[model samples]
Target: MMRNLMRIEIYDTTLRDGTQAENFNISVDDKLRIAQELDTLGVDFIEGGWPGSNPVTIEFFNRIGEIDLKHSKIVAFGSTRHIKNRPEEDANLQALLAAKTPAIIIFGKSWDIHATDALNISLEENLQIIEDSLAYLRPHVEHLFYDAEHFFDGFKNNEEYALKTVASAIAGGAERIVLCDTNGGTLPHEIPPIIKRVKEFVAGLSETVGLGIHPHNDSDSAVANALMAASSGVEQIQGTMNGFGERCGNANLTSIIPALVFKMGFDCGVKEHISRLYGCSRLVTELANLPHNHYQPYVGKSAFAHKGGIHVSAVKRNPLTYEHIAPELVGNSRRILLSDQAGRANILFKAKEWGIHIRPDDPILPAIIKELKELENLGYQYEAAEASFELIMRKLLGLRRNYFSFQGFRVTDNKYRMDKPPLTEATIRLSVGGVEVHTAAGGDGPVNALDSAIRKALIRFYPILEEMELVDFKVRVLSGEYGTEAKVRVLIESRDGEESWGTVGVSVNIIEASWQALIDSITYKLMKEEKK
Candidate 1:
């Protein structure tokens, strides 16, 4: 298929629209950091936020000016002037001007129902507000955009009135008129015809103005809709990073960018820096304190993972047979998952990755695969806990050295008073370099106490262990049939200055499971140091 060769502007609303997502909150500093990263990624426009809405947003506008951006134009977003106040007198417009951004965007009611019911105003008066607001700010800003809120629905309900709103925005000097899928109800098939009519309407009125699409993901088709709109001749795409927004989310630019460049053959400012797409996606989620969706498209961990024996074999011989594009194109690497379904190809691929040489015909290869399947049957998931799997592989090959021997450990939690919190303490003994070391420590909980005690026992012998810290801990109950007696699985994520790795442990006793994970985490750190 011939790809669409057009220049499409990339507009990112991650700092503004993305913050509306539940539990996806970030500080002003975080917004600044994200803005810098977006600029580095070469987005054409970064919608800072609704500057008039909150103090944090106002502060963001104030602080963003200090950092000199190289590519993206910082945009301040707001609504049209109020009914009671003139355009210059409206506080929202005033806030946008105060932001002193190179570009400004103001959304106005396009659906006649919103003007009548939501704004409690006549349809004609709404048109006046939309036009006057843009006219007032026309000379002050270098670039001006008018977002016709709910344009798709409004066009469906009252086509004449919706076109009238677009006419108002054009009359007031909007450089770009963006049709918004505010409720995200528009389908991909529904996009082209509407956009075709709107493009005709705009061409009839003015030749210099352009059209843009701002789509939400309520129908899980925002990306599709945006692509369809582009195919239908829209010049710009507006979306948030990782699809973070109110309700479902805005269209995800992370998925949209690569698709546009690699699949659709569109050119944009970020095309040269597209390899940063995966890292940029991870940074946004990390700063928001949210776990990266392993199954997400393009940038997900499992996007290029091969598991089935035939699939792995085929991928090892030729990736294009089973893969769409090179994972490295988006800064992601292929993962050969070592599950029960995985075969020799997966094991050999992993061995090469870890610098462990093993012959394809080695007699021990089948034994290693058998032991891996047995451990998985016993509920050991090696996919997420790769460090533990690596240790097992080394031990089976007789290549692993014993850095420490586990002696014993005890934990106690006592509550002296009803009004006070419980006291938790742990004592641990270990033999390192044939020297026995015993220590005790207290913590906020049993697992924490145990972690502290182990660190105390080992830090003196291996000072490098001090650089390692548990960044994340997750516990999952395997089943509910046995209720409290059911087995629990603990996954711990540890990181030093250089890198991070995951380790997993499972047992009926939660503490024992945690201990097993902790032991693996420490051992992995030591193993890495010894290899270096």
Candidate 2:
């Protein structure tokens, strides 16, 4: 028997729900950039924000409409007509139509709580809200999607009434009906029969009017819910890029789409443009100026990173044995995290990445690894802080890189000439590759002055740091210590050319801790560049 392909439609709502996350705000320029990216990612639909919700979103959809989106259909999203206004007369509906996009999505309350509290409408009135709005948009657009907000819990609590609401929208000519897990509490197992009953309850309409699933991740079940719905023959799936939303966030289309196309064997046209997904994911995070989650499933920093000796050894032999998928398949690079847990094979890979070669039987490989472990046991962690790890490798190689190093440094903790002035004066005497050099700098504290002095000295040799800024610097006292005098570790994150790298250091003195991190930061960048 010849096999039939399962083709599913993907609707991306990153610009809308993604912006709803706390502390995230995207500019119109950023919105346009995301639109262009999603377009290139080959999504079936790109839901720009509601046209009448705000001027920024309105202008964004309009501006984006002018740009040609090759394979994606631009969609305008909004709520149903106002309680008192007619759908034809409502300004929001008219604004959605004015957006000039090909499709429109309108959301309405399906739960009794939202109906009574949020919408302040009786059950009958809310059903009309969904029906009338869909009927009004049907004449203007070919694809009109209706979102039954909180549909699952609504169905579970009051099955008859919830299905009645969906029936109303479908009867009013909604091309696709999407059941939303607004609270994201529904389970994967529960979804199969729920979708089956809903499809069966609708009778002959399932084929004429397609089914869709839009889930949130409050219970971290958005992906599972969407996956289960697809198994039940849902034709469309809606979600945001990185699960960014109001509370626990919308489903991460970044994750769901990959699993659907790659694992589930759904012919979503997703693999044809898989390379753009990584860049798109990073672009949205950068536009929001947020730190991308390092463990974010497939695209995260440590997604493909291997650190343990046995695992690293197996991965080198054949990555597919341990890795579910090749990272390059999704435009991501494989990173082997280096820490005390690493073995000789791990060191070999790291050295190879840095353009050095070391045999597995080399005495220094095991000895240096042991030394690194001893340092870590003394509370130095090189996982998040890779710069210090690089320095350890370089020192063990006895390869004196043609670069500068600190010769001497001193700190004076006292009140300055002004009693209110910052209370630290740090003096430093350092050299670049053993060339005698000295400098003293001022800062609010010793750590600040020490870092400033190091960067200032290095500017004379490798001045690229003038533009490369330290985006964030963090420190932690290992939980084992109870006294004030206990040693602490520091993690420094530095960014250059839109790329960032992390490194670590440890010391008893806070200043010493910060200095170790500072030195590692400079060395890692220099060494990383020299290889390139």
The prediction achieving the highest TM-score against the true structure is 1
Against the hidden true structure, what lDDT does model 2 obtain?
A: 0.84
Candidate 1 lDDT tens digits, 194-308: 9999999999999999999999999999999999998889999999989999999999998999989898899889989998989999999999999898898999999998888
Evaluated with lDDT, which candidate comes out highest? 1
Q: List the residue pairs that clash in candidate 2.
A: 385-503, 385-504, 404-432, 404-433, 407-430, 408-429
Per-candidate RMSD, Å: 1.2, 2.7
Q: Per-residue CA lDDT of candidate 2, range 59-130, in tens?
A: 897698789889888889999888999988999999989988899999988777788888898989988888
Root mean square deviation (Cα) for candidate 2: 2.7
lDDT of 2 at 33: 88
Candidate 1 regions with alpha-carbon error over 4 angstroms = none
Worst 10 residues of 1 by lDDT: 1-10
Q: Which ten-residue region of model 2 has the weakest summed lDDT? A: 1-10
